[model samples]
Target chain A: MQPAHSNTVIEASKLGLTFQTSDGPVRALSDVDLSIGKGEFVSFIGPSGCGKTTFLRVIADLERPTSGSISINGMSPQQAREARAYGYVFQAAALFPWRTIENNVALPLEIMGISRDERKARIKRTLDLVNLSGFEKKYPWQLSGGMQQRASIARALAFDADLLLMDEPFGALDEIVRDHLNEQLLKLWGQTNKTICFVTHSIPEAVYLSTRIVVMSPRPGRVTDVIESTLPRERPLDIRESPEFLAIAARVRDGLRAGHSYDD
Target chain B: MDRFRDKIIPVTTLLAGLVVLWYVFAVIMNAPVQRDMDRRAGEDPRFSEFIGKTLAQAKPTLPAPHQVATNFFENTFTRKITSNRSLVYHAWVTLSSTLLGFAFGTVLGILIAVGIVHFIALDRSLMPWIIASQTIPILAIAPMVVVVFAAIGVTGLLPKALISTYLSFFPVAVGMVKGLRSPEILYLDLMHTYNASASQTFWKLRVPASVPYLFASMKVAVAASLVGAIVAELPTGAVAGIGAKLLAGAYYSQTIDIWSALVAGSVVAVLLVTLVGVAGRIVERSMGGRPA
Candidate 1:
């Protein structure tokens, strides 16, 4: 086990969360202890109702934990959120239908009171980073589903926050487009060195992008395993066929299967 | 050509059908009155003579379509706009009140909607009252508005406008409430992540989103404003506007005059609604709303 280092971007101590519903109190998360170092890409892999998304929301301050404690950059989740510590990408693009691609990206900058010149420069830089520069003036509904999602990513990247909480950002895309986006996202992570906390259900995706993959289980939503990656940092799309990559993927698949017990 | 067949054909056919129905009704209603006239004159007329006389009665129970059409044209185009007898003059009097009242109503409604959306107290207490305001029949309320305003020595255009304001504000408030709250939860969460202040969220997000709803509500409101104006004219004993024309026509049994005034009112309503629609389209387009 790695010691709790000073460079840790996130730290949690036996974190737990329970949601009170009409049926009863549902334990969305339980006894989650983890620390993520700065500039590392981490993936949380789980099935439906496994609280992978819930954990991300907790980190983003969208949900509060009922037990234990969690901190981002040595501050409470709410304080970090108020300080503009991270950017979150939802499962869907969630772009405003009436805003142009450029304007959608500009939304955060404008809210943060960035000057007009700085906003313009950041919008250009982020859209270029997402390969959506030529389509800035187009409305969200005018674009293809993939392009819309890219625009949404550019919007999240516009502010250049050090932490990016992505909840299944490419989950809705076709395999080909998802692969393409995955390559681009890996390149982006290398270029920016941001600490990315990604949530996904795909085993390959978790093994492919993450420096460490946290496999989780449903029914009280606890972490089953955390696997550190041994693959090279500079990887191509075909690296999935490599023996080392497949070995990690097989381990992740076993972790998932072990967590998903069929008994009701 | 396809548009002509799809849209124009149905619309014109329906209109022609209505005109034919009106002519038929006019003949049936006037026949009894025409029979009494022949009996008094001791002139037993033939079928053609009786039909002609029924359609062209001096004081028919229901005037023929042609009679009302001619009266409307003469009063609208032949008479000078300054003339009291001109339908155009009366229509102008009512339209001014409608426009003024509609403007005030839209502002008031948007303000109320903003309050209801932002403040829980307003949402709980004020929203119910806004809805309850609409249930009180405008006809019953019109007279009291005029009476109260008259007691305060406020008369003429302002009182009639106040009545129009009362009738028009309800739909604007209701539509805006739905519109201002229309943003998705994801987008609202996006705003929250930015730590956007309430006013910031309002100006950058809520205001632009509420526009389409504003224009839709205004279209209904403009028509309602016109109705309130006409109704105000009825009770306040105003000597101008379509309402007064109807009142005067009824007092003297000049049914042709009543029908012509009604036609003028319809034209005004169609104009106002169309104007609002055009304004809405321009705004939504400017705000990046795609054409539906």
Candidate 2:
């Protein structure tokens, strides 16, 4: 029973990861430090080779950090994971093609051994939250890509974990669908008040949705900058045109350019 | 209706062409025997007489299609089903062995696949041996299997089934292994995030994913099992089943009997494969997989 007022949800100190491949040992992340507070939407933004997704994976306990430490809710990532502390949405929807949308959403609940009636209630509620209520009986391939991703989000939200780790969940979508989903996601986040750690390569997306943006560089990946947003929590899609949003976007762009220069 | 038309036209054309070719070959092959018979009777037969005689030979090298079809119909329908002389009785004996062996082989294959997928040591050690087992021709081993089993007083269906099991299990083992490992790494990571036990992952993820592969392999395995069952009957000198019928026909130069038995065996194979396909479709649909 930890205190409810504690704001820190995830804290990483000097964390690093290196993968040993047939060619050589490749460092994916190095000397990273960050902390995400309760109910904060933190986005990790960088170029393709950057370890932003790796960092998210570390927090999810999908990949082990070779150095330093990361704690989720004051517990080791592994312990936190075992305790069902968070839900993850992959870059691809990654829904099981054999499962209908409703069954896919209900997967984690089934794994957690929830009773049938309760599982049904949570599935209905979460699908409604993602605006996917009637599409329950449809298989994943039958739905559009954006719909599939929303179902994936519904899957993540089904069990109602306190934290959500999303890795470029909408990256494959078209711009219109991406914008629509981003708006929906923000609304969902506001309503749920869950801490979200998102990884993406898009600057506008980072500036629009995040409370703070952590910019990272590739090749022995390390964080280059962390920018705090000054925008109000209740943001409209038009806020992308505001001078404040432009300023933060410019900073993220400059940090990205500076990260490229490190190779020289 | 268009789909049905698309399938029926080509198959019907090919079958008609095959029947025409069979009549031509039967005439050519039975000609020499007809010529010898005419000479012995001191009668110079006319071309029309020669053609008629060749088409209706008592035992041609390749029996005419109509002759074989007549034998097939008569043997299948005119005799009591329980009579040893009936093709239905022999086909039933062979089918029973095929089905039993297919069941045993499928279960064994799935178990082996599970072991190989779950244990790296088994994958390394058992996989090569499984592949090697298939290289020794079933024809060579069938007789030995029959002899050994007969020594142990295990005759008839069990020995034939053992050979069928041997031939059928390989495809299923290989396919199931491929299927069990088919889910991409990302899905496995998803399972890990859920803190799912290994058993949970296997049932909910691995088994369902492997189903399509299983059905494809079962089609191959069932056909092979039938071949194994027929071959196994060869060395036993058994008085029942398609293999025994073929042997008896060959002993008496009943080419019509041999050809009819071959056709009956083919019909059984098609029916068995179709049954497996229907089962696969139902299971896949019940599991919520999309139709082909």
Candidate 3:
């Protein structure tokens, strides 16, 4: 259990990312600042081509920001990794096709030199957490798209990393499945008490799930607004249909549009 | 269901027709010849004895099919692996070279594939040359490979194994290169995001992704290795091998011996290929979760 006093788990200040294409340098993100507290569910919502994904990548140390710095658990992203600071769930499941569901979840543990008996126990626990307990021996291909994604989430949880960075983890699912996953995700977040930094383009999704929503715009992308949701702590499916949720979602949409107008 | 049934009917009909035709032709062909030999056997003792030699010589062409069956059963029953003249002895000799060549070839192929995958320049320079290498007739090069290896003081199994390796490695190299590069762009980006080291990405992702391709290529390599070993043997005129038996049979007009040796070579190749297929299934089952 984390102490209440120091809730800050991730901090990024004036983070910028620039890629050198054949034509010239293209800035993907510019001067973005955000901090994620322990047990916070933060969503990065933006239009396409905005740096929401890039920002998540920066936090994950997938991409190095051109300027500014980010820290995880009071250490730089690299140092935090040495402490096993986080687990990343990609847009696609990225499950190793040659591995069974159990083995896929056991990958990070194997890398960390965990013993077989303990690894097996953790695998079962994580799979159970994702409601995938019975699918342990099945291959990734044998599962449906939604199930594969859930299994991937289970894999991220298998190592017990405190910070979970997700890049559009549910973007590919249909609406009905997406809503179900979102409700499950909120429950998972509440139960695990792990800080989650999720990236998505859906405004309602951000408003429904996040404690705070960071809205971004494209073309040398930068954050425009960070809205702290006023929804009650005990969030459920009913809250998504509430006036408060819709209003916050509309605000996120306006913030996204405002960032786009400013770019022009 | 109809499609499957239709596909099988033609094959079954053709096979049944061929078997009937074979028995009828065998009787028609052998009767006249057998009758003339029998007539000569009655005419004179020396001629009859000479006729017996001709009948034995001609046995391979018409072999009553039953004669070949009897020979096979007799050889298998008593000679076994320990006997010098046994089919098992020749098979073992062939199998050793085939297996050695396969191991050597597979390792070399994987290394070359890694080099190709890692370096673009190597891919450009080596890929075309590798493909071109296959176009060079194995028959044309067999004697040269044998002679060169002999000149280098390499003999016995090494020369034959090297020949097999030369033939077997190309498929594995090409197949693995394709397999290693098969990861999707999104997956690559995901690994990049994780800050995965190159070796980490390789073992965790690339190597596992290449399993199907590696096994598929092994089937081709095993067959090629058997061909290489037999070809290598032909050039060396090795004292103890099936190839030497084939050559001696040809020289002496012992056509039955030559045909039987051909059957032996084919049987060895089949067994090696089947072994690889079985191994591929085991690996695929263990790794990919179930057999196809």
Candidate 4:
């Protein structure tokens, strides 16, 4: 987490979203209250349909909250999105097939009408940050799944937005790749000092990466618990095996099971 | 050798089988006509002579394969190219109008697809009409297009090309409509997150995504354009095109000329579609062989 002197990057109060379908109304998110400080790594951990992704999308202005209010920095979500205040990484790489890795990363910069020289510079910097510098000229299909996801992260990072919202960016990768990416992500987060709101279903992933974990449950789709990590700022992959890490992970798991209705 | 054994062998065997069967049918079909001709001459011929006579009838119901091949060769290479009798001249006339119509049809189809994709009003209003237009006989529309354009003093290539455009545009419009909308929800949502403008989304997302679809439809459209060009020639009574040649041949009961014109048309159709396929492959390679 950033120092206590830092301002809140994201704030939500009783935020709700209900999707209307032919079957009926489905409450994807309800009464979600959370505030993320600058330079913090926060993870929303939940089972399927718990609105973890919905909340992230809401912050990105891809979905609007039906009730209460949420703000990014001082502006509303729509305003923040329009201002290009945050970068979003999706579940899939979502790379355009025709574009090379560097060009894919340059997408937002192109949209924002950045100059050619600046776009080239930012593309190089972001690709380097994701450790994808050499694969610049290659297509998305040419790379491995993990590499594609990393390229996608680089794409989100290209604009240098103060906030980064990622929705299961590494979910499709294998465990070994996931662990390596998790480590690389934490390092990248350290280097960039951006506030990151990540959504994932993996228990260890949330516990390993987040400064604070938001455990959610379905049915009405609401937050049940928030666990602040007690680990040191500097951590290694082996930290997951430690008693302190396991204890926090167990608390997060319990919070999840308590809120989840397995019978239903 | 493997390529020959695996690919060419099957194709050649099927073709050989077809030719043999065609020869058998030719004899069966021409026998009655040949019998009347031979009887008029009071000829009593051997079995082989009788068989040869049936297969070589001047106006056989179904011309033998060799007879059609000979006609194809004579009309294609033997005649002076400047003469109206030249198959090359007729083929060129048909080809020129077909190509012009195809170009217009492709541009019109893509425009309609874009309008349908971007505007709800066009999607609701134009798409059904675009689809419904195809159901009316091209034969019915071909003459009407010629008449209407002639009435407006828009004669020659434009009217005939308009018919080609009419026939070719439907497949492209439908294909491109599906292609433009082919991007998944996630990709669109990615654009939404970026807050990209409508035009940016169209160019960056829709256009590239629709290319493969465009080429697939183009192959179908080119063949249709050729048919449209030929059909357009039919009502005009123009004596310079393959369609006119077919009409004149039918008028004079010159069965060999009709067969040769048809053979020429088939060869042109194959060439046009194959040309499109090659273009598609080149594009596919340039885009790294996977368009999507």
Task: Identify the leading candidate in terms of TM-score.
Answer: 1
Candidate that would win on lDDT: 2
lDDT digits (tens) for residues B1-292 of candidate 2: 8876898888899999999998898999999888998899998988998988898888888889999999999999999999887899999999999999999999999999999999999999999999999999998999999999889998888999999999999999999999999999999999999999999999999999999999989999999999999999888898899999999999999999999999999999999999999999998888777677
Q: Model-by-model lDDT, in order?
A: 0.91, 0.93, 0.81, 0.91
Taking chain A of model 4 alone, its TM-score versus the true chain A equals: 0.97
Candidate 1 clashing pairs, residues 3+ apart or interchain: none
Interface RMSD of each: 1.1, 1.2, 3.1, 1.2
lDDT of candidate 4 at residue A84, scale 0 to 100: 90
Cα lDDT of model 3 by residue, A1-264, tens digit: 233237789877888889999989999999887778999999998888888888877777767788987778878776766566788898889898888999988877876778999999999899988889899989999998889999999988887989999999999999898998998899899899999999998877888899999988888888899999999767888888889998998898888878886634
Query: What's the chain B TM-score of candidate 2?
Result: 0.97
Interface RMSD of 1: 1.1
> In candidate 2, which residue ranges exceed 4 Å CA deviation?
A1-5, A262-264
Model 3: how far residue A125 lies from native, Å: 3.4
TM-score per model over all chains: 0.98, 0.97, 0.80, 0.97
Per-residue alpha-carbon lDDT of model 3 for B1-292, expressed as tens digits?
8966898888898978876675555665665666676687674336455434434535544543444545555654578677866766766777789889999999999999999999989988998999999999888898898889789898899888888899999999988998888888776765554556788778888898888889899889988998888777887887656777677767776656565677777888888788888887888788875544
> Which of candidates 2 and 3 is the stronger one according to DockQ?
2
RMSD (CA, Å), candidate 2 to true, equals 2.0
